[model samples]
Target: MTTGQALVAVRDGTFLPGPCFMPCVDALLYRFRLVPRSILVMGPVGAPLLPP
Candidate 1:
């Protein structure tokens, strides 16, 4: 799969149980203007985008 597709999969997988969580993911993705290649899932700021 493409990097963007994989990111979408990971995001959906994590937030699928409670779709409400998708807004945050979506907002982040929107702000970045593209799906992230990798995510850093820790820290007060939540998952940060990795280098492409």
Candidate 2:
């Protein structure tokens, strides 16, 4: 999806539209790891994706 679409998704889910590190992919995955908050990152389909 485009940035606008992403922004809409973020807003719809009440998520922080932090920034898209990966522009090639549209899917954004959020998960809690090192902090007490959800961290957004690119999926494995994109570069430097998070491990499963």
Candidate 3:
């Protein structure tokens, strides 16, 4: 999906949008892993993993 569409999904609490292609795929992969939580960052550079 396009960034805008993904953003809408996130805003509507349906799904999260990653900032880039790789991260988006990663998110989809991990999503089925049953992780209790996740994070999504927004910026011109695209979504990147935040420092823990």
Compute each candidate's TM-score over C-alphas. 0.31, 0.26, 0.26
Model 1 regions lying over 4 Å from their true place: 1-17, 35-52
Q: Which stretches of candidate 2 lie over 4 Å from their true place?
A: 15-52
**What clash count goes with each model?**
0, 0, 1
All models: lDDT? Answer: 0.60, 0.42, 0.50
Model 1 C-alpha lDDT per residue in residues 1-52, reported as the tens digit of each score: 6999999998778756544666587668757867543442342245345433
- Cα lDDT of model 1 overall? 0.60
Q: Poorest 10 consecutive residues of model 1 by lDDT?
A: 36-45
Model 3 clash tally, residue pairs: 1
RMSD of candidate 3 to true structure, Å: 11.6
Q: Once model 2 is optimally superposed onto the true structure by TM-score, how far is the C-alpha of residue 42 displaced, in angstroms? A: 37
Residue 21 in model 2: shift from native, Å?
Answer: 29
Over the full model, what C-alpha lDDT does candidate 2 score relative to the true structure?
0.42
Give the top-scoring candidate (TM-score).
1
> Per-residue lDDT of 1-52 in model 3, one digit per residue for the tens?
6999888767656333333454666566567864333433233244235432
RMSD of each: 13.3, 11.7, 11.6
lDDT (10s digit) by residue, model 2, range 4-51: 998888776653332353322233222323332222232333534633
